[model samples]
Target: MNRQIERWRTWVWVLPAVVLLVVFVYYPIVDNIRLSFFSWSAFSTSPAFVGLDNYTTAATDPVFWHSLWNNVLYAVISLIFQVGLALVLAAVLEEVVHQRLRGILRTIYFIPATISITVAGILFSFVYNPQIGLLNRALGAVGLGSLAQDWLGNPQTAIFGVIGMSQWQSIGYTAVLFVVAIQRIPRELYEAAKVDGAGHVRTFLSVTIPLLREMTTLVVILTMSGAFLVFNEIMVMTAGGPSNSSQVLNTWLYHNAFLTDDMGYASAIGTVIFVITFSISAAQILITRRRRVQW
Candidate 1:
């Protein structure tokens, strides 16, 4: 009887979290899946059973494909600039022997990350403005005026311009995560590398990089997911404009749901995003786990 009471108390502690998850997470997901199978507008009183018509429509939509491709581009760029560059920056900071200098530099780098995304987006919009923006002015001052164009207005460069802003905002945040991981490594390993006459480059490549595998995997998953789910930057910067060139999946879904009033279609897009992110994250975890087991 005492054991039964103890078990009940333990469950009582866990019950609130379970209830919250069911209500907020699981319920929304299940509802989205149900909604994706119907035809409904936000104004509709009753949803009609559509039987995968929304999915079919999405498959045939050119703008959907474009948005999906832009998301892929975003992920690729983030993997390179956000994750890879942050790793390099973190390694450089870790090598700095002066603690004060390292701390100052780290703080400087991380400042952009603490700013609100909406604010950052608005700030970059002005920075990329054609006539009076800082970027074009600097380019013109440096005699590179020929290279300056409408960064956010040109269809070819719009997505990349938005991505550049995102990188500036997020790279420091990713670097901080790497810094924590680097600090956890045993100092004896660094000593051993030094005793072997390993130079700074060699030490970083051989010692630091090898020990950071788990952290790298984590950063990659986070950056990739964020890339795909990007909405605010696009919304504030270009509104996925200049002919829908910068439209991403999330923005496209927003357009469908709010502007077009196609909630069912929007739900279908959301479901697809869920599936893509989940599958990629699951595959990453499995692969990372297997590698860890092998090591």
Candidate 2:
């Protein structure tokens, strides 16, 4: 009787969350699938079914392809700069930095992360302004006025500019994660490495990175997901700009569903995005497992 009562209590506690998931999460997912099979709710007087036409259209859309390629590029670039730089920063902070300075540095690094992505986008818009932007000012100061071309306005450099801001915003967050992982390493191992005359580089190669393999894998997976989901920055800064050069999957989906009132097509795009992100995350886990160094 007592165990039954306890189990009932546990279930009662879980009821709210379960109900919320069914309503907010599961329901929307089912509704999205249903909407995707028909024209948008806004467009149709009675939710007219269009079968596979939406999928067919999205599959052949050039904009969709461009957005996909752009997302891939963004993911790759963000991983390299964000996670790679974070690892380096973690290493430096762990070994060389003093305690107070480390805290200050972390705060400074994380400031960009605390701000809204949209705000960051707007701020960068000013910085990338062709006429009086800070970048052009800096270039002119260095007697490189010829090089001060339009950044966000130019299709060639706009995506790259977004990538830079995204990377900068992400680096500190990744660094903090790495710092947490690095701190978990046993001091005894580090001491043993020191006794063995293993210097900083050797200790890092042998002890630090190998110990944080799981964390590295986690960071890679999360960063890839976030990069693929990028919307606000592109939306605020370039709005898929100078000729759709900065368009990503999320932005493309938004334009389809909200702008074009094509819910079915957007659903197909969303589903595709979900599949790609899941596949990449799975691949990261598998690769990490294969490569994880055993201590």
Candidate 3:
């Protein structure tokens, strides 16, 4: 009887967390999915069911497609810089740099990540301004003054400018994560590699990269998911402007929801975001599990 009562006590302890998840997380998601099937607005007391209409409209919307393409571009760029280059940078810091200098450099690189996204966006805005901006001044000094243009004000460069800022803000933080993973690697492996006549490049490819697979998977997923959901930086810096060239799905959804009061369409956009993130994450998990190497 006492053992059964103890088991019941465990369930009692778990109940609150389960309840919170249902109430705050699961319920909202379910309600949003339900809302996507209706024609609704903030002012609507009764949202009329318009099954699949919002999705149909999304399919025909050119702006929706453009925003999706921007998200795809962001994810690809983030994976390259945040995961690929960050890993290489982390490896160099851990293996080549002097210990004292490594700490200082790591701190310096990570400083931008510690700043609020709004602040970073605002700062980059000034940095990319065509006239009197640091980038333009540096270009002019280098005899490339012809390249200077209003970055955020040009449709051609607006998305790229936002993407560049995102990479600059996030690359260091991703590298720091890689550094932590590198530290956890067994030193014996490196010693063995050295004894086998392996140089830094060879050792990194054969030992460090393979062993850090788990962390790589995690970082890749995080970077890509964040790229797809990007909002604050774009909102602060471009407001999806320069003729919506920098519009990402999240920002587009916000514009539809609050700005235009197209609640149902916004819900559909939210659903699309959820589906894309979930599918990509699931695919990554499956692939990682299949190839996971044990240390």
The TM-scores of all predictions, comma-separated, are 0.97, 0.92, 0.97
lDDT string, candidate 1, 1-295, tens digits:
9999999999999999999999999999989999999999988999999989999999999999999999999999999988889998999898855777998999999999999989999999999999999999999999999999899999999999999999999999999999999999999999999999998889999999989999998998999989889999999999999899999999999999999999999999999999999888998899999998999
How far residue 237's Cα lies from its native spot in candidate 1, in Å, is 0.4
RMSD value for candidate 1? 1.1
lDDT of 3 at 228: 90
- Tell me which of candidates 2 and 3 scores higher on TM-score: 3
What does candidate 3's lDDT look like per residue over 1-295, in tens digits? 9999999999999999999999998898889999999999999999999999999999999999999999999999999999999999999999999998999999988998999999999999999988868889999999999999998999999999999999999999999999999999999999999999999999999999998988999998999899899999999999999898999999999999999999999999999999999888999999988775422
What's the CA error at residue 77 for candidate 1, in Å?
A: 0.6
Residue by residue across 129-188, what tens digits does model 2's lDDT show? Answer: 889789899999999999888899888889989988888787998998998888899999
What local lDDT score does residue 14 receive in model 3, on the 0 to 100 scale? 99
Q: How high a TM-score does candidate 3 get?
A: 0.97
Q: Is 2 or 3 the stronger prediction by lDDT? A: 3
Total clashes for model 1: 0
Per-candidate Cα lDDT values, in order, are: 0.94, 0.87, 0.94
